[model samples]
Target: MKIYTLEELQEQDVKDVIQIEIDWSMAYYGKEEIYKLSQEISKCFNLDYLIINLKGNSIGNEYLGLLAQNITKCTKIYNLELILEWNSIWNQGIQKFGAQIQKLTNLINLSLDLRINSIRKEGALYLGQAISHFSKLQNLELFLGNNFVREGAVMLLLEIRKCQDIQRLALEFNLNSIDDNDLQQFGQNILNFKNLKEFSLDLKQNYELTSMAQSKLVNQIQKCQKLTCLKFCFENIDQDEEVYQQILNSLYKIKRLTFFQLSI
Candidate 1:
């Protein structure tokens, strides 16, 4: 549980590190400062777990690419969590960042927070291709809420479906342009995740979702006999009581289900 600031990390030598948490949030560091810090952190060869919180940082494509390049050098990292919410990163930056992330083939648990960014379909596709490189990933939590992702969501889900060992997944795509057909495709891809136990899908504020789509999604999810915990948020959709009841009936079919939540 060791925490280090950018200044501290740059000044001292980190060795034999098992876990390290780097907090660059709220810091007014310039691009060069971030690049130097990233270079320093890349020297730690024994680091297994790394957490980086970059909330409120105005990191651009070049600096983000530099940091990602250094991160790719840390081959021993197993669990990686990055918080880059509220940044100015766009599609090109995301693509470069994802290219570097693909080098971390040893990663098992990955959590990426790119909420409130300017990711579009191209960015989502790049990120999805990068995610497909993690064949051994077990736990994944991705926050892409409030972005321009629509058909890109389906592309990302298709890549995630390739990870056969993924057990727990929490995806946040609220306030996007995901429609009924896109959600149905997502549900269809999810059926391939046989090892998935806990799953949460947040599609709130997607005005295109209707009762028919909700039923179709429920029918697909009911096939996941291994699911123990399930959550769905579909607020502002056009679902009625009958549709809601159908979703509940589908949930009842999962004998192993312990936790169930639905918001409309």
Candidate 2:
């Protein structure tokens, strides 16, 4: 079921709708509007999968948390994709969002895009802790691009250790001020995700990134002996052909890797 506009949120029966997609991206909505939307969404008691796009909606922080809480009323949700990019949902918003969604203990896959929001370390910590509560999570994609996580990004990884069932993961922290030191620990934490077979990490616009750091991280990633697919992205790196060749050589050592992509 697809609800394309807020006007379509009628006070009607939709309890049998197992899957719902609300595409409201780039639409303008205020606090009151979101609250009402939450009320309507909560009535979908049998929802098993939801894909809501509120990106660029100019929605503020105060109501998104409540929306998160209301969405969990479905109880049967195992897959959720919430896109809140280019909004003003700051740390407080993410904290509320994260805390409320932890109630979905059955979630197996989640894709949360809070890009370009003014989130800091505290929000990252809260979000990570909340996500760690999901014992059944396997596929996860979190895009916190253009925020201020920095070293805090590592905290998210540390918490992700709890979801050892993760097999496919995509984390984008582009323009997050993360440097080599932060990713070294980040690399170490991900190595323990023994079930991880497909992984994508995007560090584009992380100006401090260098070939050396990338090499080190690749070395660490290779330790995930089960990985068959890998993708790495970064800003154009200044390196000689030999340096690039060496990096490629290191990546080639991952014998199980069937698909490899490195974008510099």
Best by lDDT: 1
Poorly placed runs, candidate 2 (over 4 Å) = none
Stretches of candidate 1 exceeding 4 Å from the true structure: none
Tens-digit per-residue lDDT, 152-236, candidate 2: 8998888887899999999999899998889789778998898999999999998887777777788788888889999988765
TM-score attained by model 2:
0.95
lDDT of 1 by residue, 28-69 (tens): 677788788788889888788999988778887778888999
Residue 245, candidate 1: C-alpha displacement in angstroms: 0.8
Q: lDDT (CA) for every model shown?
A: 0.86, 0.86
Task: Tell me the number of clashing residue pairs for each predicted model.
Answer: 0, 0
What RMSD does each model have against the real structure?
1.4, 1.4
